[model samples]
Target: MSILADVGAFALKLVLILALVGAIVTLVARGARSRGDDQPAPLEIRALHEQLRERAERIRLETASPAQRKALRKTLKRKRKDEDKAPGGQKERPRAFVLDFEGDLRASAVSALREEISALLLVAGSGDEIVLRLESPGGMVHGYGLAASQLARIGKRGIRLTVTVDKVAASGGYMMACVADRIVAAPFAVIGSIGVVMQMPNFHRLLKRKEIDFELLTAGEHKRTLTLFGENSDAARSKALEELEDTHTLFKDFIRDHRPQLDVDTVANGEHWFGTRAAELKLVDELMTSDDYLMQRMETHDLFGVRLRQPRPLMQRLAERVSMAVQRVREAALLRA
Candidate 1:
């Protein structure tokens, strides 16, 4: 009888262990299924849609007095189903929209800008317009030039584009704002500085003093005008200067074609000025903040803050979490051991 009791106890313990393991496996499988369905939408995206809806609902409910609530209910009830649809079965066009560039100058921003332009064109008709709120100290010449090109795409589509500078738009930053149909600015917003520059440091003298020599070979006469460790030549310097001048000329021409009214010579002096001064020089159309422009349009048209789709995968998030958990477990086991 004691032997039989021991056997039963062992069987019960095994069943209990199996049950716990099965529960854990089932939970992991269900969790995996759920995570698979919830594909990660975007990386570093502001939860704008969820936020807007929640905020609006809170405001509607919390601020309403009894009388106001009754009136709101009546109004809401009176709202027709047809009102939700756009005129003539078409989507209702937004009255005014925003194009905000609150990031630093980089190739990534240029890609986002390109996507934003595509989205704008999708929603905005030929008669529609855009207000680009630009703020940047500047960035790489090629990168910002590409970003500027994205803005130009809007104008090419026959859509009027307005640029408002509130913080600053210097060098390549100015290159982008200048492409707008009309440029506006706040009184103190930094504007202008139309120029191009390139810098390369040569440490050949230091290297020679240290008795360290380096050899570089190239096929083209202008393949490498400047080097980090090689001696620089007068001819190379002259060639570099010539190239810079040509690039500056192209920049001036681009501005000239866009704003024919401005004297490229005057604005191309690589000097930045305040908004009021810029307006005097016709660098800006008017002195107005983008906020004012948006507020004025809000009553007449719907406003939207445009942004690019987030680009992150669920697998990445899951892998990161799993790796973190594994590391923690390993660390804890190591501590015990």
Candidate 2:
């Protein structure tokens, strides 16, 4: 089986990744990008309020009967206001800021996530909320550790952070989620794998059969733990395992610090658990999809999604218009593009 294929408890993770993908598509539709508009603003951030309202209207018109549509149009024309009022006739509305993180082996979203977090912190004060719509199956340790540090900045600023995982947030992904004030996962979403793993295919045997020699040189005694083309030594394998166990300890300590209620020893086995089992193990705080969480918050909070986007250059855009159409279509099913 491919290393990426599941053979254990992870097989039980019936991840509703499609829901996460839909939320991400909505996030992109409401993000800081335009379609060939070339506004010269370098970047633009659209308020999700207007986008959501527009989408809602589109949905209503498409799904409602003619008489219902007429009634809806009339209501839209009328001036509307929040029903909740403060003591002095002011509206008491809490703000909800959203950001999306679609992770890969390299944790590619870290840069954009940092910028979005910075932007949100500039205007978001106390009583505000930030939700990260996140999905990642874990990745390189350093990449995710840095990504987790970016989220840590949000906590240091005293902002409430809610990380919603509609799919999988395992390994390094869980490292980032542990820093959140709340973690919400959909049923059957994959979680945990609160440990370290490393693997590589050794081609030394093949090379030997072909009468080829592979040399690996390292100054430090344990710098090169394993090699793809060189024979592996017992000392090297032992060192590699030792390092992984050490990282596992660090991983457990980090989660324990954030979620003291969790019995780290019981769950930190490089084994992923389905969302229901995760909540039972205290790996996630709640069992609900990201869309459900956001919709519930939208009623009282001014729910907005922040995305730090870079505009494509003219030449690149031209080339992309030629090539990216196929690529985009291919990646449509991915959680993020």
Best by TM-score: 2
TM-score of 1: 0.69
Clashes of each: 0, 0
Candidate 2 per-residue C-alpha lDDT over 135-247 given as tens digits, one digit per residue, 9 for 90 to 100: 99989888999989898888899999999999999999999999999999999999988877789999999999999998888897887889999999999999999998888
Best by lDDT: 2
lDDT of 1 at 228: 89
TM-score (all chains, Cα) for each model: 0.69, 0.75
Model 2 scores a C-alpha lDDT of 0.81
Which pairs clash in model 2?
A: none
Q: Give the distance in Å from residue 265's predicted Cα in candidate 2 to where it truly belongs.
A: 0.8
Tell me each candidate's RMSD, in Å, in order: 10.9, 12.8
Worst 10 residues of 2 by lDDT: 6-15
